[model samples]
Target: MKTLILTTAALALSAGAALAESHAQTVRLGTEGAYPPYNFLNDAGEVDGFEREVGDELCARAELTCEWVTNDWDSIIPNLVSGNYDTILAGMSITDERDEVIDFTQNYYPPAASAYAAPSEDVDLTGGVVSAQATTIQAGHVADSGAALLEFATPDEAVAAVRNGEADAIFADKDFLVPIVEASGGELVFVGDDVPLGGGLGVGLRESDGALRDTLDAAIQSMKDDGSLNELIVKWFGEDAQTFE
Candidate 1:
């Protein structure tokens, strides 16, 4: 998982506090439509990807009407709190610090490893200008790795920095980076060990939305038991991705 950082945002939002809501009739799944395999907009300019498929299935299993909402990653949680969406299915990782601001259903995607990519394998991954999407766990990791962290608003921007020689390498989820490296055709190569981060990816909910949490959690559990979730993981991320039994 090595997603964006969590330690910073929890201080601003309280997780697990008492609040009330009527039973949900419809739920909005919020996502950052930029991260591929996990999530990305399709050629039709619509929400389309693994999470979209999974979210739609979860909605069907829960007997709730679900709609997709695209949001900037940095403000996703805030918008959820503001009621712009009912649930966050944006490839968010479950973690202690984030759990302080919002509740998470059980993980759908198992913990994934993060990695670095550069124009050459000889690139210095531990130092120099390393790029990462801001607020991602990779960025935090880079900050602590003694590298000069060059953060971008989106993952594409971070990767672009590496391509443009603005950065020595780009650090991000290996699952997310694998395709980029494969398609680079010698333009880029894997540069370092893969680092596992985050507990796993899950649907996020406000602390008060226990009922909705239960509904989505049950749907996820059912999918896991029947191997549907694993099937989806394979379809989107290839069989090499971490998946539940």
Candidate 2:
């Protein structure tokens, strides 16, 4: 009877472990709902963009179901730390500062930033215009050029400010800004060569979650190998602009 009871207890522990592992498979994804061509809300109030497509592919490849959560850009990292979500699919750059707080998956995209100005405006961004997002690395590249820096609450606001003549130009990731420019009916134009925005977008997870991070990184690699990443970029930003390498 003692032997039988011990065997039953072992089976029960094994079953519990299996259940726990199964429960740990889902990956919760987070994104900022405003940055278009990356992750933004559409007319139907659905969150659809480049990052969303990538997130879907990642989940499929990892054989995990993803639950996407949308929040303001500023709140993304905070919420990730606070357990609001497990991963950030937002176009979040993998900067060193961010790495100190969260573990990032292998980079899924490349560094690409640019400045956009009103088409009719004669702003010479070549002279260096400070970026409005001060924490962004681009701010250092153009901080001292006296090129008229404008502050904005969000990327959309920055683009609108330029469109309405409130600001001469706005700096943003090419993947995010290019779509806005093309959709703006020739109102905005690229001001200069694309700048290297340190760190491209990646899946963000807590530093403790090494296993989950590995799974996401593998999924991203699979997507790149199968051409899904390139296809999505071209679908959103045209063939010429799909430069993710």
Candidate 3:
């Protein structure tokens, strides 16, 4: 009698957990609300920017209820794996190393170039001390290129290294650096060739979450087919920014 009672309780708990998961169909879309043009907190202190626009449209088209979630870049992937959020819609590039740990939706934004930025046009890139956001592809690139790689927790801090003369230059996304260089009024300038990195930007998901991945993949394909993806990229990063077909 006790064995039967225990089995029934187990079944009840399994059903309850399943019910909770179904109720959780209200997806949580995670992003680092610090990368501007891609994502950032607006003056209203709420998540805003390009990925925000894209994610909202995706949820609407997929007919899924989703809420925006802000997380730091370093912990972003691990949190998705741990179920803190259902998806990561940050401007994360699709790469093999990342793919080994998580599945990705099809590319929404094409691969962007990484470039060096400095206070002057004549900064040494190959052998100079350079800064990049910690744990990013740019950081790896700088480390591999014989440049002294100084990494920071955030993009702003990486740029601050160059501004404060702690580093000779900073390497980051061209689209990101272009705005800063222009806004710097000659305070900062681009140096060296623009290096293309990664495959392209895609939505990050847990490897076991196949159903959720399919839903978002379909939504991305729909956006690409309708030209809306290209429109959004151009809207945020300008006409020169990489866009999907």
Candidate 4:
């Protein structure tokens, strides 16, 4: 979905050990409170979405006290490395570039495709301007798609860029774009074929937090084994959403 930078490699290593030792305390869960159906701010201003539900359940299964902390998508990874939070459960896709900076639990959400949304199907996807949230795989894809890439700080802004004619189309997760397109009442429509990206969405952790990563991975595996994880995916993403076998 999105990418981020990291620092404090030396500190990240030690932080994991300390976090592992202090597992009984509240394990801070980091998330970008912007993406919907993944992680977003609820009406009460609390983190709420598919990831939140899955994260809460994982914490319960792991017997860990966890709390959600919101952060900007661009800084989510750097903050984790700097110990701002212990884990990132914000629908971050697992990619090779990201793995070099941080650790990820086995995917809680399966890989999904990215798609384009435009005011019309005639928008030139290959030769015209495209909008995407900065630091996201979508933006990266846009940069390489022979289209002019317009980067925005947030997904909403990126979509706005398209609606306001600042760009020809917006590229993002199909899951994220579905409701927006449907709610647009014909103002927006899906354009082009869906582009599959990344391994899947997993819990991101500091590179040093191997123990915490392993623990979370175990919890995720348990959910998958018993089918509760599939239930949660279906509950949040609808009947057509992907589920574990």
The lDDT leader among the candidates is 4
Worst 10 residues of 2 by lDDT: 11-20
List the candidates' TM-scores in order: 0.89, 0.80, 0.89, 0.91
Task: Determine the C-alpha RMSD for candidate 2 after optimal superposition of all C-alphas.
Answer: 9.0
User: Global CA lDDT of candidate 1, please?
Assistant: 0.83
Superposed on all Cα atoms, the candidates' RMSDs to the truth, in angstroms, are 7.9, 9.0, 10.0, 7.2
TM-score for predicted model 1 compared with the true structure: 0.89
Q: For model 2, what is the alpha-carbon lDDT of residue 3?
A: 61
lDDT of 2 by residue, 48-167 (tens): 988888888777656676788887776778889999888988777788888999999878876656555455556776553434554454444456456666655577776677767666
Top of the candidates by TM-score: 4
Instruction: Give the alpha carbon lDDT tens digit for every residue of 1-245 in model 3.
Output: 64664454345444434543676667899999998888999999999999999999887766677899999999999999999998998889999999999999887789989899999888878788999998889999999999889999999999999999999999998877888999998999889889999988899999997766666776776677668989998999987777764
Residue-wise lDDT of candidate 4 within 1-245, one digit each (tens)? 11111223223434444555675578999999999989999899999999999999877666677899999998889999999989998879999999999999889889999999999999999999999999888899999999999999899999999899999999999999999999999999999899999999999998876778767776777677668999998999999998877
Worst 10 residues of 4 by lDDT: 1-10
| Model 4 segments more than 4 A misplaced | 1-22
State the TM-score for model 3. Answer: 0.89
> How many residue-pair clashes does candidate 2 contain?
0
The residue pairs in collision within model 2 are: none
**Candidate order (lDDT):** 4, 3, 1, 2
Task: State the local distance difference test value for candidate 2.
Answer: 0.70
